[model samples]
Target: MPLKACKMFSNPTSAPKAPSRYCQKTLHLLENFKTLVVMGDEPDREILKMVARTTIRTKLYEALADQLTDIVVNSVLCIRKPEEAIDLFMVEIMHMRHKFDVEGLVLDHGSRHPDMKRRAENCFILTCNVSLEYEKRIFLLKCRAEGGNGCSLKASGR
Candidate 1:
């Protein structure tokens, strides 16, 4: 796919509409930022939210905030050096003439994967756990891949 420059965008698969099934399937509860901001002043928002959400882990919650905060920093950096973002949108057309150096499935939409709940366009995924080549080091502790392709990654260490 051709790379198109944008002023801002983090999710290549971000939907065009609200209450998207694709998004809801990935997340338990999706709320507009406006809704969170509207409950202003009298009470603290983060504490109230954490109390209401019994299952959310403190570290994970903080991570999300950290990621959102990064958008601003990233955006400024990208704007200053936009040429770096050209590799952000990726797609492939396979044939005998040209081929990917690595073996991996490239699908047009996220929903094309059996495990995904809904469709997404221009999605981008990155994995840093294992490199392009096979892993060389052996794990001292028992560890296994969390999920197959077309699924969410869920891994933990004991």
Candidate 2:
């Protein structure tokens, strides 16, 4: 029932010398979970699309076909503002949990915003920074969006 928020490197351009260690670590970390839920920002649309089409989606289907019975993998980019984006992402996560019974949530750029801290307050938090040279940072929030009559869910459902 604990939600984990991890802060890591965001801007990839600064680290020209080496590839993103955060990304590699995050991918490896995701493999340990049974269900995978991914949330990415507008900037990460292409990367998310590649992941959805190639590996994660396929592997999830192969391992937990029954669990994803009604799940829909949406790869559309529509939102313009940061707040709206997070709201939509959370709603999607909730929907996947309630309608499709998803066990994992993978948020790419969705967790980078500072506003997410308020939304993910109840969950566990882990802050990690690779270097200070990077001007921007992104976060990864992982939590089980439990379905029920919870206030947050009720509010978002509306």
Clashes of each: 0, 9
lDDT of 2 by residue, 60-143 (tens): 444353333223234234323544443434445322244443334444433365556555545766667654231223344444
Please report the candidate that would top lDDT against the real structure: 2
User: Considering only N, C-alpha and C atoms within 3 Å, which residue pairs clash in candidate 2?
Assistant: 3-123, 3-124, 37-104, 37-105, 37-106, 38-106, 39-106, 39-107, 39-108
TM-score of each: 0.16, 0.19
Q: What's the lDDT of the predicted structure labeled candidate 1?
A: 0.39
List model 1 lDDT by residue over 53-153, tens digit each: 42323324555545443343343233333334323243335354455543333334222456765766897756345332322333343335566434334
* Model 2 TM-score, 2 decimals: 0.19
Segments of candidate 2 deviating more than 4 angstroms = 1-42, 54-56, 59-75, 80-158
Give Cα distance to truth, residue 33, candidate 2, Å: 16
Runs off by more than 4 Å, candidate 1: 1-35, 44-158
